[model samples]
Target: MAPKVTYSDLVIIGAGPAGLMAAAWASRLGLNARILDDKVDRVQTGRADGLHVRTLEILDSFGLANAINEKAYQLREICSWVRAARLPLRAGYADCDKNPDPEDDSKIKRTERVRAKEEEHGRFCQLGIHQGFIEQNFIDFLRREGRLNVERNTATKSLQLDEALMSDHAAYPICLRIGRSTVTMNGDTADQGWRSPQEEIIKARYLVGADGGHSWTRDQVGIRLEGGKTKVHFGVVDIVPITDFPDIRISCSIHSTKTGSTMTFPREDRLVRFYVQLAETGSEGDDFDTSKVTPEMITEKASKILSPYKLSYKHCNWWSVYTVGQQCAPSFSKDGRVFLVGDAVHTHSPTMGAGMNVSMQDSYNLVWKLGQVIKGIAKPDILDTYNAERQSVAQTLIEMDREMCDFYEKGAGSDAHNYDEFYERFRTFLSGVGVEYGPNALVVPAREDGSRDSRSCTDLDKSRQTRGFSRRSLASKIPIGQRLPSFLVLNHSEANIVHVHSVLPADGRWRLLVLAGDISKASQMARLRILCERMDAPSSFLRTYTPEGDKVDSVIEVVTIHAAPRHKVELFSLPELLRPFDPKLGYDYWKCFANNNAGEEGDFDDAYAKWGVDKDEGCLIVIRPDQHVSLVCGLQEVEEVEQFFNTILVPQQRRKATAAACE
Candidate 1:
């Protein structure tokens, strides 16, 4: 019999934090997608809990920052020190803390609280939100923004590429078969154990395996995680403690002189977390059984590690033990149709809370590229950057984690090791702003002789060192290949004050920042008009590349920021292209801006000088949907600007519709 068939623009496996993010972005880009997982419902507790600053900024672009901020815990400082006072811990320390000095509490005396590096775009700094709530927020956004839902309890039985369909760029090349793992009635599972062959065939243009660390999807792709298990095993427990420990309310890492290291994390609802070091499960070759480890063992070990200062909990929220191992997949994608993301690509120790933050970031970088490809706005080749950019980051994180683990074992103090130096070196990594992709089709750098590079896309991993995004030495001080930095600017029409990034939301649309120099000058005005004419031309990249039935600026929005005083350029004087109009919506007021040179509200007008743009001659900047800078061209170089878009975008040919549609 012919197999049951279904069709979707995208199929995402594993409805965990990473999967939910991919689904949310698909919804944002208007892709018809479904999220699936073998699990019946979201995990209740005890999972990734750190939301670094950069992750929060990504959330801001998704327009879900306010909703998440209201329900999460804020961890401002991470304190670390050693506990060497041998006052004797409670009965919980039988096999922990090898040796302790009788009165050397100095190990715990010099305590230092670590404040993660900051980013201008990441306003929240850092938060300790629960993973479940993070998933729920994405679900709510999926329902509200994309009108989509997750298909729970559905396991992907198999997936293979349809090479016959591969030739057709528009067709779904990846075919996936899925079925409900456990039969259910009225949203309740009836059979605890059940089996079924593939009940449906999902033809998908793209498939994402955001499945997780032990992802079946990863195994299906035959990608190997290259890393050996280290001698560090940790038991983590989240609880509400009733104890005499003074640092219970604050985040702290207590390094026992002999009991190993215990990491403390402050969470929401007065709940605290402790990463208890388990010396018994040292390395992968050790005679240890994770199945035999219990929550009782974790809490008991935590108690003994506390020692001199009594420690116990009246409530235990959740517990788990994991052997720390650093590993990364050799490749993140195959044939540009099937891909792996999040934990599927890398896994390492959670010493610095890098697990979930990096996972969500992987999905954030991927979904938008896939969305544009499926929408026919971008070429399939854009998918090539996914693995190269992200894998480099994965490798960087592994090395950083290994470095931190080394210091954790060496002990912290003036005489022991300079833990602060190592921590400061990777300050941006923990903050999530350390990702920077090098020059390629998407990222254009300023030429050495002050000219713009017009080269097409190449798979160059310039950011392979795990450094932050590269910045152009533009007088405007804008950094190329990095998120558009934030500066306060007013809405030309609304007279409102907000960060420059707030106006440029991450809705999967490229931004053409037409930084028109002082519009009052004749030369600047002439240049602006010429660029506008090119943008408005029928054969122009902006006009021709937009998806069918969409406006010229739909895919590549043109927002104007001029150095002229806001009072001088009224909204009516400029072309409709700058401030576009929808017949039903009237005029678009958000696209135009001035440097605020009038200084009516302080230095908000110094954008020209602050951005490093000349008041006499401005330049054009192209920003990716992820907010990284792509190109910077001369103000009057209209052809160069066109080539920038033509390099990566596949211009959509306008088809003769059955009926004429008014612009």
Candidate 2:
């Protein structure tokens, strides 16, 4: 029999992006987690190398994206179109100011407009960094937080769920076996010292099979992978090249008649990654040795693909050849204890460059739900939403990958026949114009038209209008479920602008912002104060105008009041504190204010004109930690806010039978 073992709160197999994110998020939630990977060091190359905007925002929350961004090739521009010899048909990076025309009256949905606005914001642009860099950044984050204890060169030989070891009445077990060992350090310290064959059978309360495509943990749990394999083999090579291709960018896909198709992406260390589509026309057996496809072959392939355009590489950094396939597990969880993420749960072709992005997002979705359960803030059933929500995205990605492959890698005849329509659809998709999320998703609220909820939160308040308010438009708000845009906040105390996210609490929770103009208005102040107390929420109260004799220091901050009619004041008072708001700071005023000084310059008198808030009456707004609107109602009825929160956050009541089973 296998040796008995003690237990840990969580054990994650595989140290890839998904596993790393899972561990890091768990740590943030105050859970002790251990991650095991068979590899000794981060993979130098030959994996995903693109990060989506949403992934970057998620990384920002952990304070890790900046480090990676330092090493990343900021893809500020993209040039796309067909070319004869991989030449630029049209090339230019996307500028921060290329906004859609606001006055152009189109019947497009408000969410679509919001997405366009976000794209205009530019802070959420795609980042080009290799998977290794992302992993290293997460590792560094864990180290700085003193939360992650990862074991490299450690592999789990087996895993088993035991019912007896579980909490007596618990449905999910506390039993999981992880067979671990150490590698040899040197020849001298053999046998017992360095290279010992010591085995560790670890039991974990929760197990995650981040072990990748060929996941051993997944097999142990009897989760069947339900997807087919690809017939084509693709070779990835990393090289430092000396080239004069001015338009060559990260998301470039090149096609050639001479040597099939190849794509290149920028990387650090002056390196470029090449994904070459091989001519594996008819290979019946899996015995084909991919090692035969060397740098020389890749060079030849590149030469053929970029026929007229001179391309050459002097130094080869890394290279690997592997078959591409799309596969996914039927479920993300097993017996409510063992879970799978990233490649373990779903694997897709790399054409769309979404694998890493989706994997990171998976962790983001799971982490918050898991935190709520572990903290007893939410029920365990909430975890079910993980599968309900992410599975469809994974499937959608698979289809997208297939379409990308068909359009980019197929023959000339195929391209000529099906290029235009497919290309247009794909381009539209890449602009992030049409992606939608399910209604039950945590990030986005349900739509009024009864469409499924999507994570994209742009243009959510298209209904709100500002006739004369141009300085401070509602457009400044970052779309819901989208990454919070970064901007400079005037920290009057520090006399310097600070990043907005720097002051926010890292712990994921709700935030209630009260923009009160006169906190001493006995009736209104009492109502507002009572509402704040009842919400069990932290608030930042700023006054627009200080009564002639009132002390400004008592409130969070004070600013000049704008002129407004008495009727407008009765309608809504714009907080003078936000009047000097810096558009460059976007929506990060809280962070800037908290970190900087109380005395800063620059009057935002013009900016406050658009909020429709009269300088006379105070206004209260509630923003979720993810920077989405939970409620915007006035502070009069405490029950309204409470009911809204309950409706959106609390689980619905079930019938007696289902409730009993859940209990």
Candidate 3:
């Protein structure tokens, strides 16, 4: 019989964190998505186990952080250890001169203790949990949502794109032939008779390749990774450590005098992961085989680097050999129909624990754009921003990884002092908080000339001189084209404390945050009322872009944060535009928030002050579905905000007509 055929809005070619995240995004946005992998089962043992602060924030947005926190190990401080005589001792360093072998140059001592997660970043600290658990969380979400199930033991036979159908807005142009096979990660197969293989044809509007560094989809699409490998080779082993190391429980980097460096990550369940640099590979490139490196060699190298202090393991869970390399695909997508995400497009050393975090974030940034385009809520042009935005981030990560690996390899020599400084400088980048998308269809340009120079709010000051408004002063702390920092605020109606991020879930809607200052004041009230009246008008973008039968706030939701005492201002007194009422459901009280600026320094900080918005004259900000601030303008600048959306969102009538015609 001929193979059965099916259709999906998106067909993801991997079931790792990146692919699962894409599937989750599609499910959340109500899109038909199919995800597959060749592996027979999810990762059962060690792989990419570190979760940085920004990653935690992303998980929190999906309501998965609390669960992860309960199971994962919270890594608070990173202790740097080195030979005591080799470097200048600082206040935080612990000198071990009293040791019997203190005169020996090989003996290492603790140099510094750096906090793994900055306090200002968020409530979450860096966490060490196996990659399998993270993938499981996304799988659970998929199952709970009744949206998808990963088709494991599946292999892609062939892929074809109908370039002719690409011009059609509603066409499923990408095609794939896939078959079931009991294939494992080691390229081994089960008995052929155990499960008879069946093939199927799948047509998709969009295709995503999250199939790791050796990506078949990337090759099928004709994209090439453009970089080279370094001479350094490292072996990582996850084991239940048995040691007298003073900082065994702490994450640390130890560089030996004669051997190499060892980076320790204390994981959950009393397990610790050690990344031990084994060799330089030198001129014997072809002869120096990484696959030949064993767990014993890794343990020995780790033991040497952590000299004097006993280091051993009773049981080893997993071990792998890796060569440091940096490479990225020139582009993330092809003809705007097929795309690459995560390790498919970028590869680098995993020493920084960024492989999984950056990979998941890539999907997080791309899928929402795909969701909007697939749902006909946004223009196809918005999809292009994914490549432009994520490519730069991947490139930056690659560079940082290269330097970090270099530090681990040779920093014990001349580069030792610079290591701490280097780490401190890019620590935010490592935590993933510093990622910023440049100007694109999604992120509004800072300059009147349509250029985006920096992701800093200060850059807007130079651009907005013509408007006589200091864009820097309007929202000085909240940088456009970056994720909004979370702060405490109170629900206007309930007077209950809440985190700003708790209110803004990762739903596919553009948030029009009306930072309407003290609304009890006449000037602020009048300005807000005028804006509300304009939004209430039929010609408003909020109305024009939202489908006819849908709720008013369906496409672009208005969430007002007023700088006023909760008891002083009643919820009903605010204009209806801020709290749209549905015929079936009553008024939307959750959309309004009151700035909690009690001077006593309680749970709530002065949000207005933190955001750098004046308590009397406020600003209007547009936050994307991914929670990145896209546009910042004066409250009365309604036309500018509309023009911003006009570039990306499609009018509801046109979208409906297109849908009907396609049907």
Candidate 4:
């Protein structure tokens, strides 16, 4: 028979972090997706493992944070060590207090020990878990939801896209020819298990190239990675130590005057990861011969850096070699149909522990938009914003990676080396919380009039425009394009305290929050009522865009937070639109919250003051599905809310017709 034919709403090549994230988002959004990888099985061990604060926040939204917290090792502190002798005058490093002999400069000793910057605030800071465990979580979630499963042992032979059909929303414009392993021997290895292959064909509405740094899909799309690699190479090993290294159980940065530098990561299951700087050998330009390196070699380098403290491993879990490099794609998408994410779009040293975090975030940002367009809930042009937004992030990531590589290579030798200052500068970005998208189809520019500007949204170099009504000042702490900062509040019905973001799950629905200041006052309550009247009207965007016969809060979820005592406001007293009732689900008592200072938790002022919104004049805020703030407006600016949705959402009447016709 001819090659078996299949179809998918989205097809992703690669089952790594990025591809798995894309699959997770697609499954969550109810999209028909197919994820394929040539590897026969899941990642067994040794890859991207560090999870940043924002990434943990994302997992919490999905109800997976607790599980991760149980299994992963928490990294709450970092310690730095250097030569005990009189060192160069680096601002961050003071002389080692633990040095036995003041004049002995030959031994390594502790220089500084400080709390992890990420632990200063936020619900979670940093975690050390194996990449395989993370991937398995995504797999388990997909399987539990009865969604798509990854197709492994499948190799893509070629790909083709019909240019004319690219603009057609209903067309499966991208086509791929692939092969799967058909036979395996009883004792064959992972690579030798496959003998022959059966061919297959897949046609998809959209395609994602999340393969890796050497992405075949990226090459097929004619995109070139722009940048060069650094000459510095590093040997990485994960092992259970057998020696008495002082900070073996803690994350540390050790710099030696003669032996080079080593970074230590305390991981789950008592395993420690050591990244040891390798000395140059007989290697060609730009290429470090990893074949000449081994776990023994890596351990030797690490032992040299440790000095007086003995270091060896009873068991070695994994080992590899890598060169520090920086390269990024000029753009992330081809014709808005074929997109690249993760390492496919950017490549850098793994020193920052950002490769997997940034890569997974790219898919987290893109797939929701794709689901909206595919389901006829949003305009097709919104897909263009994916490139405009993520490419800028990729460029920033490349720059940050370059800086990290430079520090690791040269920080030990330079007198001006200040790791403390360097760490402080990029702490927020490194935690994955400082990322901000510019004005685009999805993010409204910070202007008073709520108007769209004709300037290039993709240019990250331009300073943000600060003109017109100045929405940024309304909530001085909440930047419009960044993730919404979380605070605690009391549930109006149960008087139970909860984090504000726990209510804003990753369900692909826009959030409209009404911060009605001091609702006990007649004026504030009156303003909230008027806004509710507009939201409940027949012509409102909530009704106009939500499909016929669907729940009112399906597309846009309305949540109310009042600056009134929890006991004063009954959940049922809120407008019907805010607490919509259903025959099966009853009224949504969880939608309304009160800023009552319950449990002496001190979260009431945190909600009002930290948000920078006055209790007397409440403001309205719009949050994207990914928890990023899109718009901030006055409570009475109902028209502005409607206008913002009009630019993106399709009317329910037209959306249903389009979806039916496509079917």
Candidate 5:
């Protein structure tokens, strides 16, 4: 008989980037999640190394970006090259010159020179950190949260999906077999441990395959990965070098025969990573002795690439040789209950530098939807969007890497040798500016203009008409479909400045921020109280001044814009809104309003300057808890918001029909 145990929710197959992120997000959403990996220790050595800007922003959500930035080797710029001798061909930052201006007085003009310098250097550069360091930080975060349990040195031998244990509301039921024992657990549980195959009969409502390219989960689900693999064998060697190549530079060069390519990137702790592509031709199944790749061979290869520049390596830290390949699964999910993410879903050549970022993002996109489904706020079919959204991203990444390989390996004399064009494409891809969701994606509506009065009045005309005498502060009005800007505020008693996120409940509840002036207005306050009660959302009221003779609800935090002498409620002035809200402040403010520069030199001020506003007045904007805008509506349309949520949360009749067909 199989021993059985159950769980609270969620079982992730791998503890790599995708699985780790899934666990972290699940914990943040108040779910009990367990992670299992075959390795005895967290991946502490060689892996992917580049972190893109957008990935940095996502990490910011978890408050890890700043920490990463501090420790990471900032590749703020890159020098291009034709060969070892003519290399470091300085071209101005590609992105800086992309957006040019004519007017001298424009904000764009003020930063143009700086932009030029960065262009001559490189703009929007990626950071180079060992994948091991990133994994360590994530592991530390999970440990600090005290919510994640990682099972090490444990391999999953087999899995069984139980049809009877499955629910009409869930996609599937899974029974997993470990080494010897079977322990039953649902999608939600903190029951993470290593058990024998005999104890493996434990059941789960859902399963995520983040197990990587050689994914056991993918095989268990019978998903075939379809893509051609490359014959190139690349060796990576990390060493603490005693050399004079600027530690800040990432040098990539092609050897004389163009048979091999060598690239170097700086790492923390006086270390550098060297990647050398070995030239060998044989049948597809030919196995080269990768064990022969040593520190001396790597140094010899580096010296050849650097040539006149002279390079050497002494203190070796870690070294490994592995073949490079490209492959991606046709689908990201199978049977609704089993989902594939990260390398399990897609694998590509390392040339494009997108592996780690893409893997983490896959988890990011899926976690929120999964949370909604588990909480019963969204239907099971909502999970279908994950594959639809991420598959395209994976395909694009594969294509980009293929192009990069052609550029690097085929020599500049080839037909694909348009270095300038290739560089432009690289900039655009790395900028994260072009990533757009499909029509089926959820989009937030942004304001149409940057005018201060766009929020309060039904139309801009009325607000403009009364501008001088009764101009409403932007603070007292909330824009539709955009995230509320955060600001620093003193407690209503004028004691301390608290960050807005500090006041938020850690359990992932939605909030309604009310920018009201006088709580003494019994009718308005009553309406707000009723709205809060109906929405089951928390409300915080802010005002410029406290009414001299009115009683306010002490339970709700009441912040004043003016001076005060209390400790409970927060206070902030209008000027604070123009400044970036530090997270240490108790007020949650949007970063869009702080500065127009996106790490670029010039400020290309546009209507979307503060949250990409692009619609007329009297419109209501509803944003997802993740801060992505979901719906835009016309004035006073609470029912529309409710309808939108219902449509998204509940599986449509058509989706239900499809699921029935698949079953």
Candidate 6:
């Protein structure tokens, strides 16, 4: 029995990166959210400490990237090393000239394992940040910007979800019997912690389980993390190590001859992170207690691994010991109501710092779509895409993590040279920039050599709603189902340069990027005029997706980029529909841009050339709020474009009527 019952639009079960991001986006969409955590406080130290560039860019979209950039250590290069091994240098080792036959030469001679070489490809300088500050940043955003409070020291004891009534627009289908208790405060600053436990029933429309790898929420939801653990063990220590090693400050991996593999990661505030591979001597096949692996043991392990180069530490932040394993839940959501995210859905080795970033991205991809549904701008069917997109990425992560672990911990030192191959192949994945989602309802598949309905848009049969694919040749440079590429485009009116994506925030709005043709041409201008009028129409997606009282740009924003020279175009000459203005703020100068240079700045990005849009005629593209490029078509194919948006964005007018019919 419950003492009290409250309704919330969303209830996030954990306070990790995934949970925080889920709450953040939900808050951004103005949903009633209740985020809870079993822990009394946020992360202290030694959790995930690396954020990829893509994650940072996403945070930048939310205007919260500055906190991490200020607090975290920026790591730019990864130095690599191999143990001393020299039979001779005669093969094709180009450096050895000497030898470099990766496969063939290694077969005959064991080449010299010399000092490490620096890899400059560590571009975009990722952050080696602490999870504590990261969580706090999200908490701050939720509090100040999101206006939502996170309930601490609270845990759900039992979850009961009544089947969601299909027709009920305001129904809270899931019920959670939660227990609230005080977390004992430290005597160093004695305060609260003495409150007795209280039980309450929380009814939520959606439930998220971001409760970490050993997720209690996952268990309660009956989702199985299907995978096996590695026999090898590893330990990580966050300490300001006093070391003689020359490259300790740089991110490096040392494969010692006798001691094993030891990787160093630089952290904020002069602290360094060490991940030492443990030797399985007498403890083979034994179930080891990671808790028993003390700091002394970790230090000794690191000492031996980085031997020859002395290593010791006094001031320590935190340390942990664990065995490597990879597992992914069969599904990310249970009946599309109780969903899992981050470690709850998938757990992998943390060698590349992929865990936290991938988890956060999972939330980034999901909540936007979820927000659309909750806001009555999208159908609930879109929720099915969440599991489809994230699970595929989770599997890719698992495969990569396994390969890296096998090489680092189990490759037996001789395979250290293979690091170059790994780095070359997966550098994009590690950086979080190269992740590509497969095709689904949300992500359209690449079109084969095919034909669309040849019927024109005159006295048309409106029942012809089927969509057809455009020629792939026109979109060679624009990657479908991937994040839109960034390039500078000059604001047509202000003449200021801006990163194409900078104007588009992740606020759950579909961005229609109209790459208009040479608008100075009369024929092209007529086509552009038609496109503008169609978009500004009363029944247009831009208008219908927006609530009656809200602005048209709320759900679908229109931004046009043209290849014409800046000198030839007048800001006022553009049609009102192309550059819609608010009565108070005047016309938006930032919405229209020129592909050509503004002046003698010589910083011309030539986005038209880079994006493969022809100088004479450009194509129209639609980008999802999460930055995924969805549809690409010629300006004339308005029907195909309409079908595309119709598939995703549910018009506001359809909300109540559809709800009533569903019920």
The lDDT values for all models are: 0.75, 0.54, 0.81, 0.81, 0.54, 0.74
Give lDDT tens digits, candidate 1, residues 42-152: 767879888887788888888888787877777665555567553332233243333335456544432454564554335666777678888888888887885578888
Residues forming the 10-long window of minimal summed lDDT in candidate 3: 461-470
Off-target runs (Cα >4 Å) in candidate 4 are 84-102, 183-197, 281-284, 412-414, 448-470, 596-605, 657-663
Q: For candidate 5, give the lDDT of residue 247.
A: 27
Error in Å for residue 431 of model 6: 2.2
Per-residue error for 32 in candidate 6, Å, reads: 1.2
Q: For candidate 6, write residues 1-663 as lDDT tens digits.
A: 326888888889888888999988888888887888877778878799988877887887887888789888877656555443432233334442233243432121222322222122212457898898899898888878846877876877788767645345457878898776655644211123433337788988888889899888899878899987767778889989888877778787666544677777899998998888874534434566776788778888887766556778888899888777789988888877778899998887788788999999999988887778777788777777788778878888999887788777643244343545566676677666676553545655447522332212121222223656644455567767677777778888877888787887878888888888788777887888888888777877777778778877788888899877778878788878667788999877778988865453657677888778886778888888888877788876677678877876777787757778989
RMSD of model 5, in Å?
Answer: 12.1
My TM-score estimates for the predictions, one after another, are 0.88, 0.70, 0.93, 0.93, 0.69, 0.89
Residue 163 Cα positional deviation in candidate 2, in Å, after optimal superposition:
4.7
Candidate with the larger TM-score of 1 and 4: 4
- Find the 10 residues in a row with the least total lDDT in model 6: 453-462
Candidate 2 Cα misplacement greater than 4 A, ranges = 1-4, 80-124, 163-172, 185-197, 248-251, 280-289, 410-438, 441-506, 513-530, 536-641, 644-663
Off by over 4 Å in 3: 91-103, 182-197, 284-287, 412-414, 417-419, 448-470, 599-601, 658-663
lDDT of predicted model 4:
0.81
Candidate 4 Cα deviation (angstroms), residue 310: 0.5
